[model samples]
Target: MKVVIAPDSFKGSITATDAATAIAEGWASVDPAAEIVRRPMADGGEGTVDAFAAAVADAKRMPITVDGPAGASVRTSWLLLPPTEDAPAGTAVIDLASTSGIELMDRLRPWEADTTGFGQAIAAALEHGVSRLVLGIGSSASTDGGTGLLRALGARFLDDGGAPVAAGARGVLAIASVDMSGLRPPPETFVLTDVTNPLTGPRGTAAVFGPQKGLTEPSDIESVDDALLRLADLLGLDAQHPGTGAAGGVGGALVAWGARLTPGAQEVAELLDLAATIEGADVVVTGEGSYDGQSGDGKVPSFVAGLAASAGARAALVAGRITADADIGLFAGVASLTEIAGSAEAALAEPARHLRQAGAALARSLSD
Candidate 1:
């Protein structure tokens, strides 16, 4: 049988590459004649660069250091894909998680963290003469409404005195004007994200996502939300635009810079050519750290299921933990690390081993 193993990272346990490797190994154990095709997935988040680097041919990593989520410096890199027919000069892939994610914060700086580092990385890629840019804006650490990023890209967020304001959300209220004459943007830019929030108001960035970024107080949320609204007005952007609120309003800022926002899952799938890879497969296997109610919403498993269905293949899953409310009917076979290892701690301690065991079990059951 031909099988495709495509999974997202188990988040703190195993990466998508390692997970696919383990599952493939286990599947091979059950069916020694099986042909396994591995295609790990990422939804415009932390693993985006690695996913592309692994799937795309001749992808190089360009390293650079920039400001981190707080005030510290971080060593990060962006992907440089070999020149394609569509993009003669090649494409630059940048992810906000590496430069300005919450993982970089020791103590959350709700009001002071910024995306300057992310912007700086983009600037570096631009300087390298990339013809196209793909930006993954997820796991952000601030609610700055992309001011810090725009600043790094040559836009000036100046106060009434014509001086730049602070680095993070603190500068939101101090913004008096925006000058974009010096900004040099790419000819083609795509903002990849799964978020669908608008730029301001109740379901917007500051109100819905700010608390997770350290805006715990109601006053802080209100202040940041209002500040974002003011920013939208200054930039002449639609505050109600879908996905404008992703990554703490970086989505809207990117749109202001001529980016087109698209669903990250679909975009990544297309980039990886997942549909073509599964065309002749008998089964497509996918998983994540947890399978819950939210797993159906543009996540790896659901995305793989759809692809497998389109290709006339059955889809299976091997998740770390499956919540009681999870809808398992979407997959032809389902396995969980918890069920294999007998406990969550055991599963977490030896994720690869348990994941392999789960894969073997699924293969055996399918062969029955």
Candidate 2:
């Protein structure tokens, strides 16, 4: 029997790499002779680089220290996929969650957070002469309309007196003009995200995502939204463009730099060559932290199930918590660590322990 295991990170509990390893262990324990394969997955968030590294044998981790969201030094590495015939120089995969994500902040610095680290990482990747850039814009810590990122890329955000403003949303609210003369040109950039919000207004980043980034006052959100509109006007780009508001306006910033927005799951699947990996498997297993109503809308499990359908294989799921709204019927077999552990707290406290149990149950379900 051949089994392919692919799972996204269990969020705060375990990483995709560790999850796959645990699942593979459980499967191997059940049928020691089974041919088990692993291909961890990510949707352009925290584990994107890890996914690429696991899938691509020639992928390299380029370590660099950059200024974090709160202007502190952050240690992180971006992935560099070795040169192929199509890309003579190679490709760089960077994820915002690692460099400029909320997890790095000890306290909410809504007005003080920025994306400088993300852009600095990108600048380093560009310096490596990569032919293409794949950026994952998720888990943002600021709502500065990408001003911090652009600043690192040589774009000057200035006030009416031609003086540079402070970093973070404070600077975004004071922006009067922008100078991109010294900005570096990026090669074929592709932004991976699922958000479709525009750059301003009620449905925009500042209005919709600002609260999560620590925006407390309604007036503060409004101020950031107004500044983003001004930035949009200065850049001569559409403020209402879909995905422009993703990652607290990092999506819009990349757009201004000539990048294309694509669905995170689909783009990541292609980058990891998921369809090719699951092609003739007898049992294909995939999972995530939670499976809810939104799971069908381009999550790892649904995409893996679709691929299994095309490959004529049975797909199973092992989620941390499966909600009532999730369409569990998509998978031939399903296991929830929460249910197996008898409580969500227990499941979370020891996710790997329950994950292995879930794996074994799913393996037995094949006979039932």
Candidate 3:
């Protein structure tokens, strides 16, 4: 049987490549002659660069030092796509999450962090003469509405007193003016975002994602809202752009910088030629850290399943855990869903064993 294993990282447990390898190992055990193709996938989030590196032959690493979310210096890696006919110079794949990701901040003081480091990364990539920057905006901690990122990129935010205020959400409400004269020109930039929330309103950055960033009560919501409004007015942005609210309004900042926003998974899939691989496969398996309604919204797993269905191949999903009432039908090509046993903590404690078990079970089911 020709089987394809393509899975996203199981968050803190395993990487997408590791997940695919585990599944491939299981399929090999079931039938030594099985042709198992492993393709790691990401939704242009944390593991994006790594996934692309694994798939493309000309991808190389460039490590650069940038400011961390907490203003500390941190060294992060970005991917450089070798020069091609379309991109003779080269293209840079930058995962914004690497610098400003929530995982990089102290959860106890998430409100104090910023995305300045993310801008620093972009600046570094630009320094290399890379015209196209594929930025992945996901897993951010700050809700300052991307003011911090803009500040690092030469966009100045002045308080009502006509002075620079302290960085972070705490100072967002005090901004009275914005200056964007310092931004350097790049040929083109594309921001790959996973969410579609506006910059303000109930589904906005603060209202929908602030709580996750450590804002426990509704009392603090107004401050974030006010700050976002101030930013919107100063930048002449609609504040209701479809994905303006993503990654703490990083999308807003990118939009202001003339970036084209596209679905994260779709962009990555095209870059990796995922559909071509699924076309002749007899079966396809895809997964993530968790499976539920959210997965249907252009996530990696759902994108793979949809492609498999269009190619007349059956798809299956495996996740660390599955939501009880999730809309499984949303995955039109997915024939079955499997969940690894134990809680997230347990799975993380023994990732390899759990992955093997999950893979074995999946292999048996597919064979049956």
Question: Which prediction has more favorable lDDT, 2 or 3?
Answer: 2
For residues 1-368, write the lDDT of model 3, one tens digit per residue. 78888888887677888888877786677767878888898886778887888898879899988888887788898889988776777889988778888777755454677888888888878888885788888888788788787887788888878898677787787788887898766557778878999998899998999888887678788778877987888888889989999988889888877888889888888988989988888888888887876878898888888888988877887777778765666342332223354466777677666766766676777755
TM-scores, one per candidate: 0.96, 0.96, 0.94
Candidate 2 or 1, higher TM-score: 2
TM-score of predicted model 3? 0.94
The 10-residue segment of model 1 with minimum total lDDT is 183-192
Better of 1 and 3 by lDDT: 1
lDDT of each: 0.90, 0.89, 0.80
- Model 2, 5-31: lDDT tens digits are 989889878888889988888887777
Model 2 has an lDDT value of 0.89
Better of 2 and 3 by TM-score: 2
Q: For model 1, what is the C-alpha lDDT against the true structure?
A: 0.90
lDDT of 1 by residue, 1-368 (tens): 89999998887688888898899889899998998988988888778888888889899999999999797999989999999888899999999999998888888898789999999999999999999998889889999999888989999898889998898899987888989998876569988898999989999999999988888899989988988898899999999999999999999999999999998888989988999999999999999999999889888789889999999999999999999999988899999898889998999999999888988988998754
